[model samples]
Target: MTEKALTIITQREDLPQLFGKRIENQAAIEEIISKIEFESRSITFDIETKDGQATCRSLAAKIASAKSALDKAGKAKKDEYTVTTKLIDADRNLAKSRLQALQDEIRQPLTELEQREAQRKAQHEANLAALGFVNIQAHDHVGSDLVKERIVFLENTVIDDSWEEYKSQALEVKDNALRILRPELERVKKREDEQAELARLRAEQAQREQQEREERIAREATAKAKADAERQAQQIAQESERKEREAKEREARLIAEKESAELRAKQQAEDAAKREREAIEAERLEAERLEAKRQANKKHRDAIFIAAKDDLVAGGVDEEVAKQVIKLIHENKISNVTIKF
Candidate 1:
């Protein structure tokens, strides 16, 4: 025969005791999630598909329905967290506001009463300060111990059963102290004012003297500068006049030299012309004398030649030989000649 198979099943309650509480808590959380999912499914819209193009009205209605569902889901999911947070915060803030209001109601009047008491005390102290109560000593009749007692009483006064009585007593003491010290303070103030006035007058006098001295020095400096400027102007004028005179003299000398040079050049040119003319005249006269002497010599020579020729012919020589001898003499071919008879 085949053996029968046995399977063992473990129940949650039969599991270890330590896991029971955790399992129970997980079950509770799952149940809450299931309920939330059920509600979400109930509100959700199912979109349908059509084969052809959808009509505008149907499409718009579907879009509107989908958007509304999305918005509602988002809001609901947000509220799931925000609702608890808002409740806790509101309860905490409301409790705190109520406690604060109660505290303020109790503290405001007490604070105002304390502030008024402080103001009264400050005024009282200010009155004492005005009288110089702390600075100036009381007279011999009003002892220091009594003054200390009065200050203590004013400081301790409050808005209580005996505030009016203590305040009046303190004011009376302050009045008596002021009455004793006012005359002495006034006398001291008058003496200080007189001394201050005298000092101010002396300072003004010194300042005036210093200002006058500075003005005098400045005037002297200005006068010296003016005098120096005048002297410099005079010197400049003298130098300029000298320069002008020298310039004129140099110009005159240059003009005279130029005229002298021109005159000398003209004389040289005239002398050269005169010398050239004299040389030409002397040359002409020399030529005329040479020509006159040449003509006289030629005439004497011709007469001599004629006389010799006649002697030769008269001596019975051949007429042609005589003529030939005369031609030789005329031509100077014979240096010396004797005619034979």
Candidate 2:
């Protein structure tokens, strides 16, 4: 019981609010309040003492228990047992409010005294905490544009007496936040560049494939024409040889010989055309093979870079900074990062 601290709640006007509203079981309410008052008398206001703190804690617990009992007996029980809702509400609200108000009156000065050092600390700490996060992380969920906007806003923020003695700490937090944020923008930019390069490669590959298709069509048409010519010349020589063996054997023999030479020329021409088509097809296949190899190597290397970047991001590095780091590592420029081929 705080005989010394109790003086703070002893104003003559305070006694009226404690017994003001007429409610059910007034006798019980009065009994609880009386018990609290008697117990509080022994709680002599020495918050600096360990026993004083324990007494204050016990007093707070008792107050809370009493408040709960009063609330349950009125606000909730009225719902279970039959009672006029309006009447119950009025009485219950008044009882609960009076109880809370009385408790506040008793605790106000004690609380103020108890939290003196903490209050002093909180006064500056609140401002320092505000300085650290002021709109810096507020725009994070919105997107990069808003985040960038917030960074600009933070940069423009005047760091002076408003931040108090925590100006340097505030500035450092802001700088660190920006350092993490700036890299995401860079990652976006670099990703776009990579996409553009991949697009160019795809376009070039399409063009080469199209050109090869057209050339293949032309080669097939040429081979067909040469085959037709060779077949016609072969048939003519066969007929000429047969006629020479039957009538005007000598003259027919020379005519057959002339046909034979023409047949030889046609066959040679057909062979040459076939060899040319094969050479062109081989050249096209070789080119395609080289491109495929190059693309595969590129894909493998890109996977490495992407994996490195993603791992960095997972480890809490900013996205753009991670991308840049991967690039530097792959290029053998960043010796500090623990990465390998």
Candidate 3:
């Protein structure tokens, strides 16, 4: 029997190259189990002789004989003795056949187990790839469905090795990887939803503000229109009042002009009547003064005529001549009164 490291010794050189890696590391294989710890299945090696020729007790003697033969060969090499060995020559062919069968029996289970392990590792890597997909950038959000499945798969596969110190660390690493990636991804998704909602609220607020501003503008316009209407009304009232005042002034002016004209005409008529009365009074006074002077002259003439007649009667001239002289004396009455002709 030959000896080597557990991993290298168990490998089947005759198997297909593609299938070799599957069984290479499994402890189920006889060669691989032989180099493992004391609990390994192939902890002891047994030698078998031809059937019916030797029992279990004789098998031990055969192993002893083989060991002795190998020791002789080593000593002979040192002594420079050349000895032809026949023990290996007689039984090597049969031993080779038996060893080949035993290794095949062990390798069958190892190949199945390794195939299962490879599948598990492939599934784990696929899960990792899905979780760490480049499409899911740092700021992006993705679903956790695939990642959760991967975690479940890893948990199931880790059952047998989780107790081992080295495997426990590897399991912890897997756990940590999942722990770090999952929540942050979920949080990013939540934040994205919140941002969308915030945008909606802002849009609504802007619309509301615009509506309020429009309403305010409309109210202001209405108020301005009302104020303008009020001012216009006041202006109209003032204009109407001014026109009425003008009409009243025109009426008053006409009345005053007519009254003034009537007063002037009445005063002129009164002045003309006064002037006529003064002229009449003056003429009457002049007529009375002339009549009194005429009366005094008539009385003086009557006295003088009486005196002239008396003188003519006393003188007694011839009858005819005396009569003519008396007539002359009456005509010349002033002469008898010492009148100067």
Q: Which candidate number would show the highest lDDT if scored against the true structure?
A: 2
lDDT of 3 by residue, 1-341 (tens): 22343224334443223222345565233333343333233334444544424443544454454445434444545443223345555578679889999998989999899999887777666655543343333434445554455456555654345334345545556666567656655766676678889989999999999999999999999999999999999999999999999999999999999899889888878877877787787778777777776777767755654455456666765556645655565566536434321
The alpha-carbon deviation from the true structure for residue 216 of candidate 3, after best TM-score superposition, in angstroms, is 2.0
Model 3 CA lDDT for position 151: 52
- Give one digit per residue, the lDDT tens place, for model 1 in 1-341: 00110010112232222222346457423432354344434442344634223443444454455445444544655666688999999999999999999999989999999999899877756654543354434343344455555455444534343335455655665556556545545544555577679889989999999999999999999999999999999999999999999999999999999999999999999999999999999899988988888888777766777678788999998888988988886666888864332
lDDT of 2 at 225: 88
Clashing pairs in 2: 1-40, 1-41, 1-42, 1-43, 2-40, 2-43, 2-44
Model 1 earns a TM-score of 0.33
* TM-score (C-alpha) between model 2 and the true structure: 0.23
**Candidate 3: clashing pairs of residues:** none
Error at 11, model 1, angstroms:
18
Model 2's number of clashes is 7
Q: How close is every model to the real structure, measured as TM-score?
A: 0.33, 0.23, 0.24
Model 3 Cα RMSD, Å? 47.0
Comparing 1 with 3 on lDDT, the higher-scoring candidate is 1
lDDT against the true structure, each candidate: 0.63, 0.71, 0.59
lDDT (tens digit, per residue) of candidate 2 on 1-341: 34433333342233333343455847434754676677766557579999878878888876665555555545444454445767789899999999999999999998988799577668768755654553434333445565567568667767786656677877787777667657755654565677779999999999999999999988998998899889989988988888777678877788989999899999999999999999999999999999998898888878888888888899999999998887777777966665554
